[model samples]
Target: MTPGRPDPARRRWRRIAVVTAVVLALAGANGPWLYRFGSEKYHAYRIDRPEYKARNGRWEIVEFPEGYRQNTIHAALLRTGKVLLVAGSGNDQENFDARRFDTRVWDPVKGTVKKVPTPSDLFCTGHTQLADGNLLIAGGTQRYEKLKGDVTKAGGLMVVHNENPDKPMTIEAGTRFTGRKNGKTFVAQDAVLVPRARKRFDPETGRFLGNDAGLSRVYVEAERRGARHETGAEDNYRVQGLRGADARNTYGIAQKLALDKKDFQGIRDAYEFDPVAERYVKVDPMKEARWYPTLTTLSDGKVLSVSGLDEVGQLVPGKNEVYDPATRSWEYTGKERQFPTYPALFLTQSGKVFYSGSNAGYGPADKGRDPGVWDVRTNEFTKVPGMSDPDRLETSGTVLLPPAQDEKYLVIGGGGVGESRASTRRTRLVDLRAKNPRFTDGPSLGRGTRYPQSSILPDDTVLVSGGSEDYRGRSGSDILEARLYDPDRNSFRRVADPLVGRNYHAGSLLLPDGRVMFFGSDPLFADPANSRPGVFEQRIEVYTPPYLYRGGRPVVEGGPGTLRRGGTAVFRSPDAARLETARLIRPSASTHVTDVDQRSIALGLERTAGGVEVTVPKNRNLVQPGWYMLFLTDRDGVPSTARWVRVP
Candidate 1:
């Protein structure tokens, strides 16, 4: 004891204290790193807790093997319970040039991914689930956009006129048009078919009035890559390789073809991706080429395609068309209705289309920007009122709230038109069943958001998650928060935050297993300073809602493969007595924060001795003809794995 200065034990204790103090000092110097590591460990422990997950839900990241990863731009939940991930060129100009289009069929249950052959660059394409259970994908990127400084050639749209009443004319790709006034030659980038001119007659006199020239537009560029080759005024151009009356009948006119920025062009290509066959079948092309179009399934099961940049990179001027799955053909709607690119148009139970005014860039801001009910049959529109932050509808997410029979829609956060810094967290709710349906302010998000991904859960709650505080998630503004929106209470409950940030080109779709799968995020910059170009997020994330963590879930087994709209179908389930509600949720076809195909329809549930019987709605428009995921939820809102059912 008296040996404190000499004892070996005292000396060793002194050395231990010194080492502990040194370690503490070093840890203090690197506190942030140490704290972060501890916090992450705590988070991992907290989320793994059964009680925590039962309340707040859980998120898991699904990183595909390096060879299978892709910049998925669009996703669709097929009837076969597999997800179709499409990333044609994936916003990469190099891939587009290399003809490296990609599509993947991912089985979430089996955890397998298989690549499918992509025929065209389906980037920015419009897609919807068809009545035949095939996915109707139409229109896509024909050319990438070129910025002003990047454009080396003088180019603009050239309108070729056909004045001959006898026959149509074909202007092949690379066809030259020499200006008669300026003596400059320009080349067409693609083929154009100019129809025969229409000969008009007087209704009363029965006399020939005049021949109206038929016009077709094609994009043309100067032969030389110099400013001197640009045109400053409108000029008539003579069609090369044409002779006699044909030469005079077919001519070109272009206004001010200069070295300016060229917008992205679209193609008329369309296809039906058959989930059963796991292949794409070519269909009749669309009547008008489209980029960033919206395809809404009508009550009759025909998909209406509207609003996009055309072949010449100009707004398609309200010429909406429809695709008939039965005939595998598209036809003009015979009605003109203008909308911005990717406008949110939902078909209502009244057999009319409702435009939510939510759009994804392109077109003049002032025109076709009002939320309204559009009668496609009569070309009539009745504007709905009271949309908050109306100017910031761009990139907003619209969800037809659960039990779609109520016709209530929730429009989530959005930003201002095209690259504007403005954003809004305000959510707007509208009930079409009201005498005068108008949007009213609902619960707000925690922060300003854009490109929010909202998916309808089978339990009647909408999961609204992920967005950016800025345009295209510029300056590293991607928002990572998520919430469950309860339409029943008209409130939002904070959920577990997502592991990844998602913004432009991102989407979420509910899986058959009651989980939500999120894919794609294309940020504009990699850092807050916007110094480095951003990389696309290809890692898919699956969110398991809180309900999934509950002890046991009900089950839907052995249901009829087909159910009539007004008929009842019995499903075998041991937990039928515990089942509270049944929902027929339409599979999702999601892209660019737009998913009109995902709707949850409430079914009348009746518990039997050993199973449950569900009756479908009598209204065909209310329950659109399609393949749906039938889920039964118990008292705790825990849903069963979906049973595939077809509404015939």
Candidate 2:
């Protein structure tokens, strides 16, 4: 061939290049096949990625129990490496009622959940785990007029244990009051245990009988020290309590993983708790209260506080703060994209923070692309791979799952892509570790709502829990469904029908043992007179996976018992009866599982025979309410039969 003549192979290669480029361009511009949703794939995930999503999501729903309570989920989940822990305020309370505290632990391998015990009310959004294995519970007052008829309750924090993972927990509130058992203790309110001090006021000799402000002698004091006062399994390292604030900024967070722990160690920056002195020393102050702000502790040992309302609900204008544990001073970062308010600040193992979702600025009205990430290395708010879902509003949750066996940072359900208030049932899988890492829309929440949180298990399963089935004033506000997201399968399956319908909830992962623990919510809280349809669920349940079921395949719809300290909970299967019932168990090891039939059981920190624990579920939703055995009938008539349910 002549030197200038194009070789047949060369000509072929050139044609291939043009065709490949054209195909990709079209795919980017239109939907998958240019049919169904002519909208481009980029339009769907909000990020540019055609390669990763083509695979399957490992997350999938395997098990769903019935007769479970439907309630609101509003607490945060704590992970210790193996187990998953979740807690929240029940729907019974109104407007941040800290009085009703409930917690549960999930064992992923065994697929079982246990309820720990708490003494007084363990408020919602006031629970955290310390490095020493103790839990730091926030203390405060609970103002629920329905539960007690206008008599507002007081609040306090209790330190509980978690090492045993199955034992009951002992708790210590600031003052010595008659516990529910003793009969003279004040209920605690929303509590947060930060490295700080707690103070109270006491009149010279003020007693309840006189008009002494109805308060006793109180003064300034430290909540926790090197560990805690009167150490033990519960609160041994957990102090009395830190002040818990109202959940603002659309997405509520207190910056759980901050690198300042070491700084709070020997250094004792200007405004931190002095480990040696066991007191609150004057350290530098943050630029703001960081109300509901998400935080990250960079590997370099600095704290980044971003996006929350400052006392008022206005997105802190261009608000982003950074704290130096060494200096104990807060500095102003730059303006973040308007993403946080109701967003989740997720940090990967690599020390990067992913700020996703928030309706902070626009409650259920504004139509805008919420902000995404605040990169520390670049010290700027960068765009996330696929965050902007115009349809999903109030994307308040962003959890970082462990690296899949193949290695990926799996980012799941955030807000909705529909109207601002709706939980668009949209979830995405992200692999930030990849060179061209992007997000892929995994599965729709299917009847999903808003304010839900997700947790990852050892096998790499993501469990999604609680959110309002409807918006604030809209119908179906309380959602009663929970699902598992299998990243490998690239899909979602409803695991259990909630005994209780809940919204604005949180989830945590416990270590050593893995289980998905879900807390319930009640809608009668704020306004008892007006019953918002599908408003509350007052029970809790644990979805035991077959892997965790030592008894082998459980008979579908077989009777089971509620496990707690103080008593042994047992049940007689109603499989033969008309229906099954959910046994609401509390933290007491006494096994006082009263044969009660309802949606869910609101919970708080309670004492177990061995260590600390929360209230848990017996059977799950989809069953009926009554004192009977739990056995699967597989009757075509059972509600939501399409949902996954196991039979013995």
- lDDT by residue (tens digit), candidate 2, 545-603: 32232222212222233333222323232232322222221110000000011111222
lDDT of 1 by residue, 502-590 (tens): 99999999999999999999999998999999999999999999999988988667878998988998999999889999999999999
State the lDDT at 160 in candidate 1.
99
Candidate with the greatest lDDT versus the true structure: 1
Point out where model 1 deviates above 4 Å.
1-10
Winner by TM-score: 1
* TM-score versus the correct structure, for each prediction: 0.98, 0.43
Worst 10 residues of 2 by lDDT: 588-597
Residue pairs with clashing backbones, model 1: none
